[model samples]
Target: MHVVEAPITITGQESRPQIRVAPPGPADRRIIDEDALYMATTTKASPVAARMARGTVVLSEDGNVFLDFTSGVGVTNTGHSHPAVVKAIQEQAAKFLHFAGTDFYYDVQSSLAKELAHAVPGTFAKKTFYTNSGTESNEAAIKIVKWSTRRPLLLAFTHAFHGRTQGTLALSSSKAVHKERFFPSMPGAFAVPYPNPYRNPFNIDGYDEPEALSDAVLSLVEDLLDAAAPASEVGAFFVEPIQGEGGYVIPPKGFFAKLKKILDGHGILMVADEVQTGFGRTGKMFAMEHFGVQPQLTTMAKAMGSGVPIGACVFDAKLDFAVSGAHSNTYGGNPIACAAGLATLRVMREEKLVERSQKMGDVLHKELEALQTEFPRIGDVRGLGLMQATEFVKDAKKTPDKDTRDRVIHEAFLRGLLLLPCGKSSIRYIPPLVVTADQIRGAMDVLRASLKAAAT
Candidate 1:
């Protein structure tokens, strides 16, 4: 057992979190009211009104400092306003801000593309398309596969979230609320079970076994393709190695390898969505590295530019659009974003954040597992590296306890810790890769206190 050390007080430093006033103070309330009146009703995780952020902390308008465990929903992998990234952004902005890469050429644009092509998994000659968000990357990937293969159908898994755009929204099946009233999603999208051992949909012998779960999911896909969607028309299989919004669910070992075999047999391309699992968040530079399965194409965003708006769709060189202007985007690969991306990648390599994530992940897993032993509500703790989650359950039957989960989130906020809920009944912890052992210890302590307060 990893012994619990004394709680570390991360304060006094400019980057460390320190709460002066309780959350939702006068200034925060004023901003919240203004936002509620002006902003759309999409959603708000908490009433926090952030004034500034540095590293793993956010300073709110309420004068409360918070340990940002959410990492802006997994965007700030290198932490908020990393010095190197800011410097690169400033330098690049001074030279040029925007020059449409689709029409003109920029060194930073192609340079970042080359760097990404080399960094992405797979040893084949690769090409890249830049976009502005994860959804746009998925959109580009969808077009690339369909155009390259001349196939119309695409396959995604249940509880999967690719993006919110029209084409990618059709691929997402994480929540009906996300797609509600936005009917008529893109055509020729199909869904299959994703082989989650913790919550297996297939009722088979030894369902909890990785191999058994893998076999069942593959068999289901085989049957579905045979009966519903034709294999000949399927363009690609879009998958997230670690399901992000679907509760940080990690599939069983060898699952993607088997899935790849099926897709390859059908002459279908595999599109790996690394939106939330890429850029050193998952210990490896890419989550696909963990499974040893090489994707023909990969869509990346979120942490690609360490919070800068940059997304990339990388694929084997052999795959190309059918014609000129088949797919292009304005503001893709702008100089400032590219500079930020280049600098972010440099920091990742220099600081060895990937290796740090792996080592610290071991400590985090041990601590969370210890929590599971203490709290009956913590039904499961699963994920890779810094992207981890704890599921809340109500009874011995393991039913979802969303009430308790919401309470914990609220209580954690009251205690100056920021967290986000994923899936139906789980809290995801995806702190920046720059986090330390003391910070992790502090987060776990806050979670413990929150759980206790919520239980009361």
Candidate 2:
């Protein structure tokens, strides 16, 4: 498989880290200062201002050319400004930007919707609902399930990061800060323990006995059905095939299969939130494909449009809204975004990025496992394909080391390797599928140096 040498040859995306004047230089500081004053306080991972990027290379405002492993929080899977995606966007924008698909008809929106319906998991007839982001896609799923099943309750995993929208936020349990001031989220959502192999509540050594971990979690799920949130009342299970923000935690093998058996028996819909894990991030088109369970509904965004800011909730066609006006978005399926999405799909297939993710993911895991062997502070290294993470822990007991994690991230930024933090003390390494094995090695080298610097 041919890996992209650089995101773009003419655009000057650095193949490796090059810290010229250190971070927060005059230009970076200027943008940071303006942003602090004007922008609302949100999740700001690093102070480095992105001037431009291509593939896995990011050119910061400070003129520091950095290797980007974050993929803009798992959005740019086709690589930064992929030529095909760029051309499609330009061509579409030249024609028209937004015609409001809900009110009007457009071939771009319908074409992309058809593609999404096909790309998403499930052999059963499917339909697509376009939205603007991950949260909105999930919000659509929430409506679909509740409206279809007429069930008052929804099931979500503990430590799952669904979204910030009030409806999706009901299912989000990653951080209290996300829901601290916001009281009374869309009600009737019950949280269940996710079968996180590394740090589950049961303290089972899942790496040694994955089935045992699955059994323990499945027991609780059964209990939930038997007791409070009964299966009859639960409309759907909002699950991330591989938990992203809650840490790149992959559930134990056989867990999903068991859980799906139970959900099927109860006739509860399974909605896989592929927002972060979709579009070859997990070496598969959708992470749920790895588990071999076909969810009735799938929510996707992030990498779908190759950074064009689009999302979709593909559901069983039978669950489509009976009323025409029940759910509709103003700018959804915008021509530019849809065109970008179409181009992204083409690029993924034409470039064989999914296969590359599988191949390079082996290389990434090997390097990470090797690195884990060197660093005792690294409690766990888990993930699939290019979407992987290392949890920083204090000891064998696996206490989360947030301070150490933050320090490592900061050090990495200084060294010109941009990364993002997930869960409490885990740093996610999700380079675009276009990322080469050499880029992974270079990023790992920066991580090794960052880990060493943070140990001080």
Candidate 3:
């Protein structure tokens, strides 16, 4: 209905996508041109103008529907515009909009906070600090750890992306462009290696020797604490259970537990940036659950509000700022956002989306690994649950082949399957949990077709 020339429709359960014409056609250009003319330059992956979406199907402005594998960059875990979430948004909008819940009392805000505290993995008494996005959640975590531990230095991993804010940005070292003009990031932020199974500083193949990779990284952390960043001065060790922007890199099996043990000995706290991996993206409720370690602070945001702008820093109650005004935001618990959050939680529970993520993730992973076997360019296929990716390589040495990856993305787009890229030369396939086995197979088939087209 969005485009007169295009009558194509796609759904979350099937891959029967039809594209009468390539995207960025006449119908997509008016808005795309206007956005280019007026909008600030951001990470605009493609010009597929999305008019509306339902479940995993994105109806573009041109009426060219796409099988959305990006999940709106992992924010819509329950699928796009679920009827329950939309109804909650509608009902809440009718009641009241803004009430500064940070200063005043609100039942919905408190209820959602309690739900998050219970939902996030941790046995200790936890509290939630609401924010509008993942960066702010991480920002609150940074402030809390510093205030609680009173340490000047923070530890993070190389190729780690916390956020774009100054404090979280200081902790982020994933890409040089993120901090290009930003000079002298927050001081005393120590950087180190993550236990990447594919490639690492030690040149150990992580797939073959995961334990060794973990041990070498652990040894370096200890040396850093003893040397440049003294344990007495480090506040917390900030980590991603699964690196998001850096790559869909999964740390070795016991890496986080071992790191937690070391940090525990040094009087340091662990902060898991679950902004991207939270809300059942990685088969578990949170990726930290995958590691079996409870972080003192867990920063979450992406899927918490199911498309609404909401985020929370759920930390152990012991770390709550001693004073109220130490860190507060104006719209921490906006009423409508809370309603959407509550609805998202219910949808996940009633629909059993977390279990679906695990089941569908197994299917996706198997298919991707199969693609790896078929395509020599696929250097590595790695991830947990629906959060998956394939790294492109020039040869067996695994030199990044970004051109091929980008071309494949463009080719897939033309064929009606939308995807997002990650790391140096990889495409991440993070379809919503609601996606079906048939949809997964169809998407992979499209991927194979695009791969062949890109190769030529």
Candidate with maximal TM-score: 3
Q: Rate the local accuracy (lDDT) of all candidates.
A: 0.90, 0.89, 0.91
lDDT of 3 by residue, 228-329 (tens): 998999999999999999989998899999999999999899999999999999999899998899999999898999999999999999998999799998
Candidate that beats the other on TM-score, 1 or 3, i.e. the better one? 3
Could you estimate the TM-score for every candidate?
0.96, 0.96, 0.97
Number of clashing pairs per prediction, in order: 0, 1, 0
**Which runs in model 3 stand beyond 4 Å of their true positions?**
1-14, 204-208
Judge candidate 2 against the unseen true structure and give its global Cα lDDT, from 0 to 1.
Answer: 0.89
How far in Å is the alpha carbon of 447 misplaced in model 2?
Answer: 1.4
lDDT of 3 at 33: 92
